[model samples]
Target: MKLLVLMSLVYLLGSTEALKVLVLFPYAVKSLSILGTGAVRHLLNAGHEVTYITVYPLKDPPTKNFRQIDISKNAELFKNDDSLTIGYVLEHQVQRTDPLQIQLVTQESARLTFENENVKKLIEDPNEHFDVVIVDLVETETFAGLAVLYDCPMIWLYSMGAHWQPLRLIDRATNPAYDPDYLSPAKNPLSFLERVDELWTRIKWQYRKTFIIQPEERKIYEDTFGPLLEKRGRTLPDYEEVIFNASLIFGNEHDAVRDRPSTPQNFKFIGGLHVEEPVKPLPKEFQDLIDNSKHGVIYFSMGSFLQSNSLPKPLVAELLRMFGGLKQTVIWKFETDLPDVPKNVHIVHWAPQQSILAHPNVRTFITHGGLLSSIEAVHFGMPIIGVPVFFDQFTNIKKAVENGYALTVPLSHNLPKDLKAAIDVMLKDDTYRKKAKELSSIYHDRLTKPGVKFTHWVEHVVRTRGARHLRSPAWRVPLYQRLYLDLIALVLASVYLFFYIVSRLFKKTPKKTDKKKRN
Candidate 1:
């Protein structure tokens, strides 16, 4: 009888711990979607039932508790927009350093996601309920409508290092003085001009968000979620307030990769959550190439979004010429076949990037400096030569350069010479290699794997019913108070009043001040 009672208790505890999670990652970007899927997979591993809304679906065998709502049709929106492509940006000489531009794109993506037939059905169904909602935090405020509809705690999964935008929602915004904007190329310990530029960039972004993006997002939010709230006899909350209602933020950052910034208890760092553990062995072809390399090997890739085939012919020729002279074998991730390839250079249409980086025979990485690529390089103890294209790529590269394990070559007229120089320096110098190894050691020294930590915190939030106690008090403070602007204004007013009193008293005794002149 006692044994039966114990078994029954265990079953009850297990059943109670299992949560119903709703994950919405409607963005079409593969890299961004990967982060969301990582969290979803972890949640599933922890025995939670997940309803995943994504443009990319996991290929794993179907699980009993996992249900995916495909929004792959959203990818068509990106297919029609070429402005974000590296080829278009390069040919048009477009600078994608504006945060507002990226936000605008995200806003549009959120609108389309709501309009998705499956997504509309899910939100419209009153039966659709979840214990918690996890959404991608890439300027995706409109998705918060689901959280409101379900009346569940929302968690933001930030795909990059701590940025001011998302931080402001959960806690105080990071200072622009030391922390550069993610879109800016400026590094930490910023120069005077860089600080000025950073502040101006932030101001512009805030202005645009308040005036342009938020208004449009509010309309979309009300149109989608307003009816649901009305049916429940609940009035819609302020859009700004709804977006700020998240209980926790999971940022993809690690102190080993970047300097640790001040974060609230509610904000968790779970960088490298997507990195596979005990990395899979390389395919035989790649293994043989790495093993047979005479001196060493250099791996080159422009990430998923930027295709190497889009590079100009002259630049391609220049890269080929440079690779031909090098004793080190070059493995380039190109999308299409190129004519007159060098004997030393091998081209693969697709690459197992992490697998290649893990190889000891690979010396240096030539990359477009996406955050994931940079973190992978540091994780594998491999030095990199960054050729940043757009968005946070420049900032990621700048951070890498400052960290001593990477060098950057601009995509300009001097790119050929600069690329060759960077590669040669990275190959010949052992300092870069040493620094990379040091960082890798730090990255691997964590007590718990990022995936496990991510799962624990997420479960903690659900178990604690939003963990509201972990939230920062700064969120309750007004912006003016947080900035100490109100204090500054009071002090200024006091000084002005003191001066005014002193001036009036002096005027009453004015005759004494000019005594010498009167005599």
Candidate 2:
């Protein structure tokens, strides 16, 4: 009985050391932010105290205890700062090391820095301290120096698919190339020019970081953390040393995307970190429609940003014509009333996307290949016809093609008959459906749920003092050094020169001597 009581006491003591985490998202929280909501939900459920920071102030925010950082109040720091274009912001900020400009840069930086300070105050004022800081990749870069200021291990959580910009920046290494389809790995591969285009993108990001991003980042660190670290007799850790929570990238991708040579240790693909949440059932009418539709339904949505209402008339007319021709009942997530609606088509201003995807009668999804949409498609085993627009959407859809689950058509003023042909092939072909189900099987058959894996990893960071063991050491090698082909080229060149010289010296001169005698 005494032993049992001692064990119980030990368990209680162990449970009391839950991680105190700081999560930062520099952008507004969106319904589709899997990383933001997934991490927050997992941490909360795991009994971790999370101080989630965002730039936007909320009127009636989450009842759960979260520290929201509002940056709207300090918009004046960007005053007359026209030179710092988003494209060139990082570079200009880095080059202008003048105290005055650096001061202004630091002031802007302080707003984000202050948010971390606020979190620190919350902990320290109550005689508490965070075990770790887990930030979205974009947010992590903004207040990068703050990780040092707080003297805590940091985790960089990338919320999206393997975008070239983040991958190269984080690993400082390049891969062959990635398809836009997000799922397909082999087909519709990037051409040499396309691969060079990807390289160019990295150059832009590098320029932004070195010239603009790093300078501003440095200013913020110098102002907020420099003196603080000096007092403690310490310096900042190199960015590569920071543990990155990219494990999702490895998990959510289909075999087509992952089968390629992905550098291990640095870019951990731990995707599907979000799972379906319990929510109210869809309206009875919608459920009834799903029940009645014997012919599989086709779901059409343009995603969050580009509203259906904003679509050009030509595109709308083209879509309506295509839908009118379809035998399947078309469910369009349209925001406004359409002038011409086919009898077979149903228009609902807002559709429960996940709910719709979950339905068995739902056959095909036509989407913009947003990460969330693509993940949902994979989750539901629904083949998609992606019409990608911007950012990673192109690559996501390309990957889908590579994976053999989707077809893609560019959004343009004048689309050719090939667009219709592609759609017709997708509709008639059974291969897309079979491959999609295979991927879904893999997505669901993982050892652990995405949310659980994410939470466990986050906790691991706290437990292991930043999970530095997981970091990729490849970031240290310079690009030229990593290629090593340059060294081989030099070796080959030296051999060629040595052979050429020896051959010239040993060459018989009898032909030239005879010709001179004849002359």
Top-scoring candidate (TM-score) = 1
Worst-scoring 10-residue span by lDDT in model 2: 90-99
Q: Which lDDT value does model 2 have at 10? A: 92
lDDT of each: 0.85, 0.63
lDDT, candidate 1, 123-230, per-residue tens: 878788999999988875888888888888899988888878888888888889987777776777778998998898888888888888889999999888888889
**Candidate 2 local lDDT, 350-450, one digit each (tens):** 88888888888887898978777888888888899987655456657876787889998766544335456676787799899999999888877767776
Where's the lowest-lDDT run of ten residues in candidate 1?
A: 510-519
Error of 1 at 435 (Å): 0.7
